[model samples]
Target chain A: MTEAIQNVANPQIEVKDLNLWYGDKQALKNVSIQIPKNSVTAFIGPSGCGKSTFIRCLNRMNDLIKSCRIEGEVSIEGKDIYGPGVDVVDLRKQVGMVFQKPNPFPMSIYDNIAYGPRIHGVNKKDLEGVVEHALRSAALWDEISDRIRSPAFSLSGGQQQRLCIARTMAVKPEIILFDEPCSALDPISTAKIEELIMNLKKDYTIVIVTHNMQQAARISDHTAFFLMGELIEFGKTRQIFENPGEKSTEDYITGRFG
Target chain B: MGLNAKTSERIAFAFLTLAALTVAGFVLFILYYIVSNGYNAISIEFLTEMPRKMMTEGGIYPAIVGTIYLIIGSMLVALPMGILAAIYLTEYAGQNRTTWAIEMAINNLAGTPSVVFGLFGLAMFVKYLGFGPSLLSASLTLGLLIIPVIIRSSEEALLAVPPEYREASLALGISKWQTIRHVVLPASIPGIVTGSILSIGRVAGETAPILLTGAAYFLPRLPDSVYSQFMALPYHLFVLATAGTNIAQTRPLQYGTALVLLMIVLAVNFVAVLVRRYYRQKLKI
Candidate 1:
């Protein structure tokens, strides 16, 4: 009876009244959501609906964009990430991100995965084991183990995407954000990424912004439907898909509107 | 007769080919003229031995060494500063008034005449700093003159590196400087090295900047130190062709010196091309 609004008993990430603006245009308006630990939460909306913008806020990736100003609170593990003392680099160490486009470093396959660990001062001796484990987790080790020394560009597009995923996993972040990761991927590749993401939630809290409603339904434990910049419904995926409370949410899920 | 597309295209192609060939033709003509006149002076002693008599003997070796020294010295100062400035502009500086002003200043500085830089060097390094008319003063002045180009070429190289690389590194929790060191700079190395080396050609051939700051055209020995006066190819050629008592007698020496200077510049540029290719292969870009 006295629970907080849209509350999770223990949220790994808690964002409160988060607002964002690019110059004069407000991109995110009063977005408040609590993402539970070790679970998959999918952000679904039409193009430019602020889902991507909101996910970028998790790792402070939006900081790279000039004129992007943020306000309110984004707390991870009870610590406010936007606070004055917080270093963006340290914050990103705990929150990894995968881009829509596959961007492997212009390096060998092993170096791509080893890059993060090497920078974070992981021992050189442990690096081989770490790379193997990360690649195995991303479901890519079996296909390309023979060419570990090959340039990352030698891989197929889907394999490259997985390599990027492995690269992110190498850092061992607490949370992973996927921004339309499958949008550029073919169906088979998308399925593979979906399965990998589903498996990853056991160790990492996963947040994904997706245009495909079925993808959100297929993999996510919880779903947040966004219309324009506002969160319309936040609930279990089954409820949101089968019977959404908000009209806009119902319309979006049923293909009546976006 | 009215021209059709095909006929007009042929005429245009002819004009374009002529234009390109004309430029190449002039370069070849100059090369032929210099090499023909200077080939007689080409001997081991001419290249390696010291100059003798009243400006008409031995070798231009001291001048050659002095030019190399100036090239090395200027690059020592310019390379780090140019690369750092480029990194700051591309990575850190916001699109504020400060960055705008800095960019404008760099561009305007590039267009400022070399003689003006020479004069400034005379005032600042030679006179104010009391370095005197020496190799140190000339090197510093030439460094200032070439920095704008280095900054611009480096900025272009930095811009050519895919932004996706920067974002990828940063999202992996790497710091800005670490990302630059590991990814951006390494990727842009070929471009930076090529541009920097090619600019050395310009540094070798500059006359006025050294004229005010340091070049002596008659130093018997190698510059004893940075503060000592030195002779350079352009100034030696200047003294051979225009100054001194034996201008007509040293005409052959002028052609020889000019040929040597051109060859030095060409040799440096050839090394630049080789280095660029090697890096491109290693980076697999």
Candidate 2:
């Protein structure tokens, strides 16, 4: 597996010997993988598997959990994120996240996009351009450009989700993590987001966690299957969907069991 | 079983509607009683002139000024202290046994009787602290009485702010304090302001606390400073109705004072309703 993955250039994020516990219960066990630069990687698994938990560990989102305990090294661009003197706040700036729900702040549309830039102390003069560029990148500018001053809740659910993505982009993050980004949207909205994700891979490293197998096959370059706190298989999306390496992976993929 | 369920549902709906109507009826009854007895007594001179004849012959100007002073003074002390304590309790405090105990204590304090707070104020501020029976003492006592109310509501307001906002802000690499200032506090402002206004209404007409700490029997001149003894609307009404030598002659004045106090409370409540409506429309929530 190492020889097969070594042919590619140095991966953007390297995870090794990762283990996690929620108080007395173990949630992730010995999970290790490499994420390539500027590509889409999908973590697909059944519910209660550690796929969501693993994705959270990428940017230390799980640290917000009171009982969560982690033991492993996760490095982004060769620097160990858990190493001494590293600030979690600064680390998150490089790795943005979109939650399962469309969680736009109950504020103006313009204010929602400007929140990140304002936090970073960006000049007022530059915020207008930044907001425009971010909305344009998320393919949302044409729909919402005229009503930028309106409250974010005025947007449709799908538009709100895209606004969230644009908000993540406004911070200029190198990696964007989506935790079931389209689970709340209809099929049409889901298709649009999938297209956006494919186009986003040209400049940003995208990591998505999804329960939908078709979505994983549609947009992902690499796919990792998790089951009961263990990574069963990690390979190209096409190979994993066509010829899974493990029995558990094939059984789960073929609808034998979740 | 279906027939029984239908009858029971109709009975419950009727009972609930009756209960709501009872509340509306009580409010209307009070408004009618106050207005009928007090409106005839309300004149420009009755409002602006100083009381005479050892009881009541003129306006309650001094009491009105003193009430305003006390409200401003107490709010100066209570608002910031209560808000800060609430923020500490909700935002920074760890979820532990100690936090639970503190919350329990605050809830119990809010339920404590008004007169008990008066006793507390008399002992702590007037006697021990040597503030004496002056405007400062009365204001401080009232401030303590209302602090629990403020803390309870402010904590609720802060908690009502969605956790998702905090998560999103932190994910953008914003510090916890910055997130609170820019996102959490802004979103929660409507709740906080409404809570403060409600508390203000409760504190405005309070007589028990001020009766012990300040509430002079007769003061023709306005309170010149915080240290000066003062009269207040509720306390003045109490004097005219019960303690006055000419009780029969002062009856009209007592009703007038009560009406004014009620109007002030209604005005504060009206402002709170307006603010809530405006924000609800703007936020669309």
Candidate 3:
């Protein structure tokens, strides 16, 4: 436990020998990686490569699926989250997640940001400040501060996605997981979210699953390449993209075969 | 163009128009018939006063009050149980054989005859529980009759609430119960309320169930409590239409009661339509 704590002091997440299956189909296999603290780490892969599945495992979102079975050690802040008696809710609180599609709750923008804090018992009096701070962190407050009471659906798709990011930030989670956050947005919106993600790493650890290699190269400090549910390569983003050591990595990044 | 093809296309178009007009004409005919017969019987006094001197001398106040009581009473009994059962079916229960069986049972319950439900109510509430022939027994019978309807509608409403809402709430680390309370219920409220209003309409027009379990013949007063004996519109209308005293002189009274009963049923259905429209408008925004 003490050694685990030492490892976590410098890393936000540590997964060891992780494997996952959905009924008879294995989605991940013997994957191990360290996500460093206060940095952006991007997972780049083709669709169905288990990038999203691995991140969902970080917050225990896979537990919601009936046939899903996970085997491995996933620890956050040196505590093994998969250990017995560990509260999945607590784990999720510390590790917030944003999904592929922008899903703002059917509510006002202010309420969307306040939802997380309120659930975790943030005081009503302090809620406004939290909401404002989160919106500002997500780079959305300047655009939406005047219409915080408007329904979130009123926002453009890009703005709604940012509001979702703001909602995750409002909970003050230590780690934020983005599952293809930019996949559904326009180029301008994608660029905006990418910029916001880069800035967010100054204060929070971010793990993003993205298919855009240029995005991983531009914003991420480290990148992990996954294929067929296996972690093919992991290293500095510049090293992986500019001069990949593995032939498969070279072929994929060079647009040979996704 | 081939003559046969062209002629057949024209025939098809003509038949389609005829079918549309036929439906419209049928609806208009029914409305005209009801209005032609019912217009003269409707009066302010007919609506506001109770049946007097064996329904020959007064209005349908007792019947109106009784219908209201029946609807309110049935809704009070059915709403909680229906919503809870819907929640269990949609959110908690897995899609297993048992859950499928329960769903089939609920669907079958919805299709059961109203008279059969009346018999069940008589056996269960009036006879076994010894509630006597009173408002309570009548309400319980009607509630049972409508519970399946409410459950089916509520389940559909709950299911219609986008799964994304549940995921958003759960992803925020909200407990499942809290997610249901804060997100699922609020979104489903309009649907549930609309379904309940529809169930109220069913209870308002139901005559067979009340006949089996409620008080018989004329009652001079409104039900003062849940357990009090009461008069209802459907039973009163049925009795006046078929077996009222002073048949020649009391024909107008019988017509008035029938018109009043029709109005009550229409009013309940109209309110339900309004509620559904209101929810749809809110959902659009």
Indicate which candidate wins on TM-score.
Answer: 2
Candidate 1 global lDDT:
0.91
Docking quality (DockQ) for each candidate: 0.76, 0.69, 0.57
Off by over 4 Å in 3: A1-9, B1-24, B246-251, B273-285
- Residue range A54-135, candidate 2, lDDT tens digits: 9999999898999999999999999999899989999999999999999998889999999999889899999999999999
Candidate 1: segments with Cα more than 4 A from true spot: A1-5, B1-15
Candidate 3 residue lDDT tens string, A199-249: 999888999999999999999998889999998888778888888878888
Model 1 lDDT per residue over A1-258, tens place: 013337775689999999999998999999888999999999999888899999999999998888899999999999999998999998999999999999998899999999999999999999999999999999999999999999999898889999999999999999999998998889999999999999999999999999999999999998998878887778888888987778888888889877
- Candidate 2, A102: how far from true, in Å? 0.9
Top lDDT prediction, candidate number: 1
Error of 2 at A215 (Å): 1.4
TM-score of each: 0.93, 0.94, 0.93
Model 3: colliding residue pairs: none
Q: Model 1: what is its DockQ?
A: 0.76
Model 1 misses residue B7 by how many Å? 6.7
Model 2 deviation from the true structure expressed as Cα RMSD, one decimal place: 2.3
* Cα error of candidate 3 at position B211, Å: 0.6
Docking class of 2: medium
**C-alpha positional error of residue A6 in candidate 3 after TM-score superposition, expressed in Å:** 15
Better of 2 and 3 by DockQ: 2
